[model samples]
Target: MSTSVADYLLDRLRAWRVDQVFGYPGDGINGIIGAFGRADNDPKFIQSRHEEMSAFEAVGYAKFSGNLGVCLATSGPGAIHLLNGLYDAKLDHVPILAIVGQTDRSAMGGSYQQEVDLHSLFKDVASDYVHTVTVPEQLPNVLDRAIRTALSRKAPTALIIPNDVQELKYSPPGHEFKMVPSSLDLTWPQVIPDDTAVRRAAEVLNAGEKVAILVGQGARSASVEVQQVAERLGAGVAKALLGKDVLSDEIPYVTGSIGLLGTRPTYEMMRDCDTLLTVGSSFPYSQFLPALDQARAVQIDNDASLIGMRYPYEVNVVGDAAPTLQALLPLLDERADKSWQADIESKVARWWETMDSEAHVDADPINPMRLFSEASPRLPDDAIVIADSGSAADWYARLLRFRGHMRGSLSGTLASMGPGVPYAIGAKFAASDRPVIVFEGDGAMQMNGLAELITIARYWQEWTDPRLVIAVLHNNDLNQVTWELRAMGGSPTFIESQALPNVDYAGFARSLGLEALTVIVPDELGLAWDKALSADRPTVLDVHCDPNVPPIPPHATFEQASNAAQALLRGDAEAWGVVKQGVKTKVREIWPGSSS
Candidate 1:
């Protein structure tokens, strides 16, 4: 049988070394689905419960694997469903290629069923590249460029294939004038800034007494270099949320995550630092950084376009983080006085103690912070952790301590919910030998996580190490937004919108033939974690936690406190519980050993 456009597409993806494509089925993509069957599932099609989950799984795979992630969908509704996750990829700067099917070419202009203008819909999210394949000759070049652009730009790209065109006979571009042919091989170049910029950055660091370094996901490969530079300059390191796994928290000088979900030491260090060295991080909260006039700053990033925008820098070096820091290391003079670093270390120690005290503080049943705290010490060295955007992220950011080869991430820039469970699925696929863990809130779990649990039950046995623990903070509230409404909007928690219907998350997991554990008290958390970790298949831990525990910012402003007070006066349903928990949690910070 002669090859079809759909067959050739899969062949090309396989040539690019793509092993899986996450997607859902639809009539618009029937041709491709048929081709997937004919190809004997080469470059396997991993079916997700929804198109949105497919895109999110692709994002997770790309983020953890350091490769191009691909997702597929049918026309109109399926394509539209992919937007949120694609935007997540775009915002987080992950490389993803979304292959969407469109209506038959003849029915397109006549507005037949599912005949939506996919190009306009995808234009912004896949701004780097979004094209419609009208003919078979356009196949290889368009697909190759989409793959290359997504990889090079670290952004999402798209290809809209008409259903009729997908069924057409495959044809290669001719050797004539208008035809373009493409290659499968691509090698990324190591980019480094010129010598002059490196020298200037070094000079600024060498002249400073108190130095602070900030890192993001882009500095993942530069861990050793970041540490070396920090040692030479007597700098304290602060990690952006996306860079949480870049450095081990065990390092005395390494402050935890920055911004709203950050450590107190990080906030204090940024407030007092005389000089700043930002490496591969685009942390958006400038208020959390040093005062504009107080610190001389230098930024190093691979993308010149993103540099020099977040802050005014004395020097902007366009280079890969590891090599750039390596080059700057030699030029930097070692600091003779270690008093500044000593102070930072002391602050870091105090911050951890405070976090511990807060985690152990009394709650109605299970303290949410204690879940992450217990997991931190018990996490496998090769674990891959993922957190959804909610109160779960608050505790994950503050309580978890990443060490050894443990890697953790979430929808950092997007801060979207529902990716926690799907990301763990993707992570498990990305590294089958590693254990994966995910923190989810009750809201997020109900939104889409419950369905993705079926996806896990379907594939968990295939994995070499069958440990995927889903820890659900079953607080029956949209805890993050509830707190935001009170603290930011000065409005009371509107129970109608904030309250969630309680569901048996563990029971649902057991129905799917996976291990299920329910924790209602603090003492059950550690043992539940152990059982889940040792389970033969995927496991779910549904812990009934207090919804009133406030996720206090590192440095709370007077205005925010006033807003919370106003919200309480306005008759928040959980006002008394909020006041009680907030006081107890805050008291831990003031006196770490005090049991209030």
Candidate 2:
């Protein structure tokens, strides 16, 4: 029997143990999708509503499930659409393989409708890009290596297949594929560095008057290791938005997140710390980092590129955080530094004292902080929250405070839009015990194929388990970024400057048989939330929000500020030049030990 190149692609994915594949298909991918059906014992293929979301869904699935997420897209505009989400997978080091279908090989020069140089386009985003030219030489070892790079480095990799390859007929007796294995030899230190650095760190930590440890995404994979370091140091642990899973709030040292959406106490403790140690956290929020001169700081991470890349470090200890801490814990002089830890704890106490007061509630529409607070009380402590780009980040930053019981994934450095629902799907598949909560903006949701809700429904069909999940849409009908751009001295009227209207998200959800609902205020929130947690079905909650909500990313545009000062003669505000100086300040504070 003869097989097609499309069949071989499906075989490779199966060999890699991939169970689900995501993407939307146009004519360019028709042959491939057709070839990969149940008749051939193909791995199940999932059709997402948007190309970008498919990319995100694939990455999130790979990240949580510890398996490859395979996504497909047609070339040209379709391939281009994959970049934003693909960038997120690369930045976060999520293992995903995007198989993009190109225009027929012969149409490469004519700029055919679906024609694009997918190889060159994906070079920066993927670990490697390979296209099947002839069928016989389909290197399985090479295919295996692509997956390895993505898994090992926490990056996205690509496999491009042109239409010709997909349609080509191949005879039996294909070359047998030999698997490639992980090649890293651990002959060197399994840990990060020598005992000298750890001992010095322990000494400073033991002597500190106030100590706070800021955790970041780098610690996500080593949550246990990070927890050990915090316990031994007797340091209070506060996380960046991405570090929510490291230490649960139930744990003594695990406090809230620090930043615009963070608890003020975490910020206060960081500022008050006599010594602050950052563990695997390149937390990129400068607005919350402590004064560099106030504390002795040390950083631990596996990637050297992250070291001293943000702020100056009093001590740069480059090694594995888990082993390094285990070695340091025993070497330390066991003298307790209770008062310092106590003092920072006191500051947190004060901040919490005011948190519940009228300040936490707001009537102003689209206040992300207030929205998160209200949503927080309604959400399951264990639910995973996937936040999208734009003002949605602001809401998650302000409102999505993680109790130790909860965990989720959102944008950090390469904060792009449209990953919310798709990421939520991935997170759900990764850990099925808890329902996934997707907090998305109206502008963002339109970009992802909400039809992905169908994928969830299909997988959990027959109401077999009764899926209890919903994508909460914060629908504000404007790019809203126009406000930021105007503040940034850029015109607000650029392309896609405004969000489209007449979007009936609930209507769309209903069509898919998803239990869709919408919330208009704090009171209506509980019903939807409670229902999601109680049932075994997927849901979509589309809530209308005020378009005036501002971004949290220090977006006071210098140009706007200058004009405002000239017109209002309001020299009361600081100069834009001063704010510019703070970019490096923000960079260092969040990326301690990194160069600006």
Candidate 3:
């Protein structure tokens, strides 16, 4: 009746306050599965439909909860399936620990079933730290270090346990030679940049009449400080996609988002700024930033490696966003002239008006922008929004407004698909009392979202506040790639590659006992959101949207415009619709008050 390695591992996770593990079972981890049964699910084993989804759910949990996310998977194919999601966590800099089962030790070097080399497989994705536990004594130290490394580095880590080792009697690392003992407690230090660096950054900010501030997810805890700094410098703040909710969109001086899926005001601010102060963001698109000689820039980030990257900076301050900003604020001088602030506010106001006009534009069926626009005002103050990569991200970025305690995220760095529904599921587990919403394209839904709905149905009733809504843009096309081909490649829509098979997303939701609605027109979007948000359980809104609606960039280059024109001229499958929708959507920016 002694504790097995599997039992001790679960106990250790519980000791670390890990209450749930998202995973799918396989024979490779039969010993661990038996331990879960014996432990009576104290640290609940939340089974995902697939191993990839499990990793994604853990990432989502980590992101929203601001804690360590742990995922489990069987070895071989199960381990391979987890790479994409693990890469998502790694690239996004989320803290996740992946515990994967390996083949039995007796079969080592024998090429047995499910005996792939896991260490090599995970070395790249979990390069921060990846280790295998060969003996019962090695379990505690390896598991503890994996958790500590994932949290400290803010990256994915891995621990591989062989089937034979998992069933062996548990034993602790003693005071014997060659034994490495570990501790559970870890206190994060408050990192603040030296006063000299802060002063130099302040001087750069003080000299410029036109200051531009960019914030990323690293600024999440420093929203107040970011605002104070922006106000002091008379700057307009722009958000990286990962930092969308760092500051409220309701702030007059805050530009919506930066880069391709960004607003015109943000693009113009970066283009015209004389001083650039980047806080906790590594927005990769250098083209969207100020020209090399145009501005003096300063960047503050905790990670020294990412500080001077993306853009050259006059001063790089290595520290946490909140404390660094706090240090810099005292040295900053408040600008008496409010002209730059006034101009930014004016542009921000006009941009919202343009978004409204674009949302109301007529289309073949539903305008995709209308779904997010209508949902924005109706979202709960504490709701968490998750968007999948693709066309849905376009609307989510430009149209939706996040304020109050509301939070939102996507696969920002990796830009992967099929994590929308799984992320939502994980968010619910992270904050069971808060409502969760997901914006997904039909292509993503078909890829993995539909199956995750069954996972939703299996656990929705357990939630204290059961309000999870999934809005699927049923455009019947791989819309994002379709637009990319026209804009980037100067190629007409390749029907075979762009078109998607029609699926009854709403029907599938209803079949799983969840409330479902299908909206074929724009007017129904508002009511659909209202119902879904108030539903006692998870709901799906399958809105048929126009695939030809172009996701035009805020500042589309002449080359991009020319390429798109060439695509239509070459006889795109929906050339006429594309032309009509593109013109209608773009005109709203020129004449915000015009109805036609």
Candidate 4:
């Protein structure tokens, strides 16, 4: 007898370290589910109320483990529903493998129920695909290759395992299964910029009195390199929020995140700095960048296109942050500029101590900056933060400083909504015992199907509570970024449309059997939130807030923009005119202050 294709595929996934599979069941592939039952496997099968939630759960697992997240569905509509959630993983570069059940070979012409062309449906979304027919030999190769491709590119892949194929029986000694290692030995590229370019960057650093280093997400993997580079020049450093753990914040050069939620002194120093060295970030915020009239930027990154895309660069070098910095560090000389670094550190500490200026506000609702600051301390030191997109993410970046060991990852440029729910979902499944939090906007919470949260509830039951997620809901009835857009004079309707309405998220969450509460006051936040955080199950703290609030900009940039604000110190209408004209007159590049 020949073994079934689905069984072979399952064996391969087991070898790939898939501890669980999330999916919605249907016809045409009940054979695969049956096979899962027969094996009495350790990888638990999670049933999602909707197929969309299955995909969300898979993404959650993938993002947390940095491994292949698996989701399954029967052919036709089941396979199709996987698109939106799969695309979430794709855009974010999360490794996911969607095993979609297809119809029997005999039903090729759509004779069977729920039959559809799997290839065409999943096109444009799945980075790779596996077509499994036979169980003995061919299927395993497809499984290995598909799994490898997903992990290699840090992207998702799809596999179409037919129903009839899984039911087919094979004889003894037909084939043996193979386990693929999840990691590869990757190295810096052989090509390095000539010593002359390195020397030029070194010279610019040596000559500049008030130079600063701006770290991006790419530096996360190269923390040592960033530290060495910052040390060689005694440079002050500020990070894009996504690069939270690039280096320990204890370093004297560290000044915190740059942008709106960034430090005033860091922004001012960037403007005053003779040289700005940007590494590995395509930070979208243009307004927070240093002035072109003053600072000359030197940039290095693995991606050549990002160089000089946002800001004008006097020097551009293409290489990984660490390798390039390693070459440049040897040519650098230390500066006697401890004063600037020391001054910035003092200001950063001041902001850290009283980020809300509570001595002034007395009460502020849902202070994202302050929440992250206070809550981050309670989290496990080795905990990994998997974040969603939107204002929730922006706040985490602005406030949360990672201990050297904690790693944080989020949807980068794709910046898709609803990822927070799925990400929190994934991280919980990946590390059941770790302190996992999902601070997402209300809009994102709904997009994350209720079933995913229920699944988290189920896991927490087994893993001993809070094994799923500490979900912090920002309920402002508006997309937080809409406030920023309006601040720039965007259409009111567009801004209004983003605010979610009419959903009783707390009620819905409580209905799903997760611990849930809604907070109306600031003092109630910490205690009510801890109820969920301290619970033995998943919890959501739905907190209402004022949507009209905008992010606090970096103090130093505020001073310059204040100086720029001097261009129209006249009055209200006058101030609007100055901001409008200034924004329009400048080019649309990330660092819009560039004259070029």
- In order, what lDDT does every prediction score? 0.94, 0.64, 0.94, 0.66
Question: For residues 369-415, what per-residue lDDT tens digits would candidate 2 score against the true structure?
Answer: 44555667667777677777766666565445466457777866687
Question: Candidate 4: how large is its RMSD?
Answer: 7.4
Backbone clashes in model 4: 16
**What are the candidates' C-alpha RMSDs?**
0.7, 7.4, 0.7, 7.4
**Superposed model 1: Cα runs more than 4 Å off:** none
Error of 1 at 472 (Å): 0.3
Show how many residue pairs clash in every candidate, following the order shown.
0, 27, 0, 16
- Cα miss at 266, model 4 (Å)? 5.3
Per-candidate TM-scores read: 0.99, 0.80, 0.99, 0.77
In model 4, the runs with Cα more than 4 Å from the true position are 109-117, 128-136, 169-210, 250-252, 258-270, 274-328, 358-376, 464-471, 474-476, 481-485, 493-513, 529-531, 552-596
Model 3: residues >4 Å from true position, as ranges?
Answer: none
- Put down candidate 1 lDDT per residue, 1-596, tens digits, no spaces: 99999999999999999999999999999999999999999899999999999999999899899999999999999999999999999999999999999999989899799899998999999999999999999899999999999999999999999999999999999898989888888988999789999999988889999999999999999999999999998899999999999999999999998989898999999999999999999999899999999999999999988899777899999999989998999999998998999999999999999998999999999789999999999999889999999889988988899999889999999899899998988898899899999999999999989999999999889899999999999999999999999999999999899889989999999999999999997998899999999999999999999988899997989999999999999998889999999999999989999997
Ranking by lDDT: 1, 3, 4, 2
Clashing pairs in 1: none
